[model samples]
Target: MLGRIAPNLLIRIAGRTTEAGIPPFVDLLRIAELSGNLPATDPSSTPAALLTRFPHLAEVTFEDVVVPGPHGPVRARTYRPPHPNGIGLVWVHGGAFIGGDLDRADAHWPSLEFAHRGIRVVSLDYRHAVRGVHYPVPSDDVLAGWRWAASHARELGVAPGALHLGGSSIGGNLAAGVAKRLRDSRPGTDTIPAGLVLVTPFLHPFGAPWPTGMLERMRAATTNAVVSPEDLTHMAWNYAGRRSVLDDPYAFPANGDLTGLPPTLVITEEIDTIRTSGEDFAERLRAADVPAVVRMTPGAAHSSMSRPAEPTAQVTLDAVAEHLLGRWSPRAA
Candidate 1:
């Protein structure tokens, strides 16, 4: 028994074991294998398949629009609420930089929820890092989509300067990049979004050290079992394409200047590795004198907000709706 247990002890000593807090519903989803591997070649991972899987989209009122980008035209879906609050949200979907689309379940569910709450949501089907496309391609597409949303706010019936930007996972990183570009651009060139909502955002592709206790627990969590450190490194390479680009603020929002960013809300998962980075990003925003708040959903894993049935997920979505409606208070629970 000692011989058999010695290797296990050694593995733990090597810090290869983590204690992720996986909820029952998430466990039933069996996301471990799916998260561990990139779905670049999987047909089911395509955007079309995502839309087909979620057939209730017709229940909501939405329109598909084409936005012009540097490389080409990018498609985006706009969901309208029956009672408009005059606020708009530009959402981007996550796929580890290589997969995912506007129709992604994670993006769809939240968009519908927000739209129903009276905030118009524009989900961008930005370019991904596939077929030789990488880095700036996706980021540029997101920027174009944002500009279109802002410029056409009048026609869309959304109030100017009331538009908000957001994304999940890598999508969060792209949204942050777009916000930064808007802030850095010539004054009055574009309308800056009133706020940002980052859900379990992948902000630090280059890596950041987590606090000791948090790191140990995050590593031990089963919720993180699907994604290994190697997988993250691989995804980063796919997005950046070159090592030099890794340092680019657009590629890693954590490295960018956080000053002048609009009021921001960063939502993180308690058991996810990216939580540390997301929290740190929020801290940076505060340090830069930007109004920022960070909230963690206990017992939640990466992308848990996509689950509409989960109470914590509902809380997360409600928080987002509040933020978009300009009612989010940093001191509120």
Candidate 2:
């Protein structure tokens, strides 16, 4: 019966009848509907198509570079500003470890936005689980990209040791894992990044217990359409490939040590299931004497960053820019 009904019509009906208010942007519902109508195909091809469909920014310049990944050569796209600021950001795209590419709307737009603000953005096209790859492999690819950017910083016109790392969704998981690796590699050296920018990062795949009121607010924020526990479990299994490795700190950052990470900025949305994990990670960093902050976007859902023009997305972008540019204070958010 549900399959027989139109997606838009179903969305409208749910909006009208549901106790939870409608999601902030009607465009989000439209996107969901459109996605449901698309043919089942290779997830790898989706990002290029999405980039073509959402070609909004034109001021930023982009160049493709191939980095030597652990498995093979990984393609990365660098977004550059007209004027340089001497700071670089290495970004990872999110796709539940099965999908996603550098050209994804969420990844592209944020990189463009940051580039426009004078930060050099390098977005990595890491190996995905769908391609028969699994944990550590994906993270390894991301770490390779980071190292490439760091080593090539002078050529990229970015100052050495001024590189920051970030990602959204699963990309966030990779970024956090990479940061941990860098932290542990050299005990006394300043191998850590300048900072970390995590946007609605999926740091924890396993659901954590949240307060009743917080859960209700998240449900209302997402209109009860967030990722279900079953989907999370499947995604975890697919990415890890083995149940025993799920607890590996690098694979699931929630299980990792939080000490010695650089100053971190964790941005989350009110309605997303990942919000709790991101917030909890920030708390863990603070407890470990790391400078960490959490910025919560009100009434936003997961992947809201994909809709760059939305108010919530705009606010999140501004917060990220301010934090990276050293204008944001921990007490301010």
Candidate 3:
């Protein structure tokens, strides 16, 4: 329908002309304005904001509980399906290993979509590196969530073997770390997730800490300075922690071999800085015959899944649900 309208339709519908040299994003802005219930500017402490913003959505219920983490106790919210569940996603929220709780902008969609598709998603409020918590704390907490989900599978209406783990951005990175830990901890069983969903994850944070440019700009936007580029570099190292940081897969998942991980789905925004890393992990995992499928969205930017309703984020979740529900009947990719 959008393509049917002339470009001048903006002026007709929005009362604003896309005059000379304007980026294509004007239409998106107009659409968001019309929709009006998209994520609020502040999402961390305000998730009912989305509930009020998009009331058309249904078939989801949120339950809060305390689950045991490797370090200690952690908070988690389980997104339940209206129907029974066949698959569950133990999801970690993205905040660059620093910030973000389950109520943040990104964790909102998977809860609804996964539930609607009859898939359960346990969104973990993992201990972050900020506020003196770090590395294994977050990863271990997610692994613990998986164990809890598996143990309570019958209660959650899922089969024992259908649970999966995934996350976006740093969440994806932590999910990868959890995968390695699950494999190492549980041998000779499918206790690990049936598959993995990595969305523009930060898998290679060691020898390469974002190539010293745009990512640095993003980092700076989120953190104030010491004012030197090297300070930013050291900040990453310190966040990962100096001792045994390399061992933490969130900082460097490439160190671990991806040989028998699981069937995998990867989503990357076109302009996301982590796009290359996500695709790289996909290629490596597929080479090992890990059943990896990667989707590189056209015209989507970094953290596309977090804010606004972009086709890339929407379609990626659609494919994930289909694959999990065994309804992936689309023409072969």
lDDT of 2 by residue, 1-333 (tens): 333345455556445533343222232233334442212222322445534644544667899989998789988998888777988899887766665566666677788878888898999988767545678898999989988988878888888677899998888899998998888886754356888989888777585556667656566555445654545666677778888778888898878689878889999987877788898999998999888899888888886776654568788888888887778666454
lDDT of each: 0.74, 0.75, 0.66
User: Clashes per prediction?
Assistant: 9, 0, 0
Clashes counted in candidate 2 amount to 0
In order, what is each prediction's RMSD in angstroms?
8.5, 6.7, 10.7
**Of models 1 and 2, which has the larger lDDT?**
2
On residues 124-203, what C-alpha lDDT tens digit does candidate 1 reach at each position? Answer: 98776766677899999999999999988988878867789999888899999889988999998988988899998988
Output the number of the TM-score-best candidate: 2
Q: TM-score for model 2?
A: 0.81
Estimate TM-scores for all models: 0.80, 0.81, 0.75
Candidate 1: regions farther than 4 A off: 1-59, 212-216, 219-226, 331-333
Colliding pairs, model 3: none
Query: In terms of TM-score, which candidate is stronger, 1 or 2?
Result: 2
Candidate 1 backbone collisions, by pair: 18-219, 18-220, 18-221, 19-219, 19-220, 19-221, 20-220, 20-221, 20-222
